[model samples]
Target: MDTGMIIQHRRSSNIHSLISYHAHVGAVTSIAWNLFYPRVFGSSSADWTVKIWLLDCFTPIQVLDLSSPVGGLAWASSSSTVFVAVTDDGRAHVFDIRLCKTRSLCTQQIRQAHWPALSCVVFSPFEPVILVAGERGFILSLKLSPNLRKLHKEARGADEEKLKELERQKMERIISTSAIS
Candidate 1:
């Protein structure tokens, strides 16, 4: 078992790296397996690229290269085709992975999202909201416009009421840990 690669455990207390997907040239910065779509996952690397792959296969479905290294990636918890990737140059990109016609380009991109460097990008489980964190402890919250139609509106404050509701929902979860951490 290669310790540096991602492994998944399904339906049991067993862990395994299903395939040998050496998807990056340099250090892999982040990996995100879609919580809802079991077959899909995303990875970012210091090699200046973001790669998306499917389970049971070794090669990435698509790769997006940038001028700077990518340090963070996350799949949208609510959508089947949406994901976010952050670069070391302080930019966060929103991509519709299903857009195979142009996998090298992003559907929407947010630049200068964080000073120094952008570190992470995460999507809300319930709403079209994104949270970003980076250098100097700078944190930002942006709500995707209707249906993720707009990524340029504004990086406003979070909605306290909705966030509280989501927290309440999580408090009700009752399950076992059966997957990769």
Candidate 2:
């Protein structure tokens, strides 16, 4: 299998290449940037792996294997460390790096008997819900439980800068811990 590569370009500087990531052993299926962190992103692949990466680092900070080809992935709008991935096996996998890095927090089948494989996933910007799209034009919306979302009461009162700082710290902690392990 050909190794999947991700090339980063400087968006403003004449579209020049800035960095390259050798992400997976199969085609890269999807890429999603963290809503709160400019430098953090995640990529899913046909090789059945989803990897979280930092712009300055060549290596992935964390990797999750789904045991089936990943169709697509999207970062949660409410949290910097949370994301959801859809797979060819008709399931949606949710991950929160703060809660666990080695395995998904939830894996639920979204495709029914006659439905096609899931092709993409997107989190709602205003609510704790996600919409998964299947290859055959089927779209399903799922509401996330409070535990999966981890929405704190304090976040409502916190200023944007403060919330961003907290999120940055959370991501930093994950990176530091992953490096140690």
Candidate 3:
């Protein structure tokens, strides 16, 4: 919102504008409603905060703070406990915000963006796969099994090998393209 307030509208009825005011200090950039928890939704703003709101509530149940402004935000497709937000600095921050919780905290990040600011991020409805859109004209679909617990193991083993293999494949493609040209 231009006045730093997030509003909700009712659908399929004559009624409209459910809430009169919200708690963002700057222009709100994005908003998302959880697929599983219809009463729960999220709002992100240029004020560098993300707020979790229950339906028909004026005060937020949770608020996440960041240094830079968030560009996009979305709730997990199937899980009511999961949510994520993306920023302009090539990062996607994830959170575990189940309902009736007292405090808010960030849980994880999807992955580093493609070396550019990310515009948006969405999770697949069926699986844990995530799609991230970058401002540098690219969209990356990543199958991230790199959970916080699995990350160390993957980094020590699978991830390094995969990175080497990908680098080799890129070099081969470059060489073949140069020869063709």
My TM-score estimates for the predictions, one after another, are 0.66, 0.90, 0.66
RMSD of 2: 2.3
TM-score order, best first, reads 2, 3, 1
Give RMSD to native, each candidate.
9.9, 2.3, 16.8
lDDT of 1 by residue, 1-181 (tens): 2233554444435654344567777778898886655566778888888876767666666677866888789877654556788888777777764444245334345555435677888898777788987856777898876755433222134365554444333222211111222
In Å, residue 150's CA in model 1 sits off its true spot by 9.2
11: Cα error in model 3, Å: 6.6
Looking at model 2, the pairs that clash are: none
Across residues 71-167, which tens digit of lDDT does each residue of candidate 2 receive? 9999988788889999999999988888888888998987877778888899999988999998878888999987787655657789888888788
Kindly report the root-mean-square deviation of model 1 from the true structure over all alpha carbons: 9.9
Better of 1 and 2 by TM-score: 2
Order of models, best lDDT first: 2, 1, 3
Off by over 4 Å in 1: 1-19, 100-114, 147-181
Show the colliding residue pairs in model 1. none
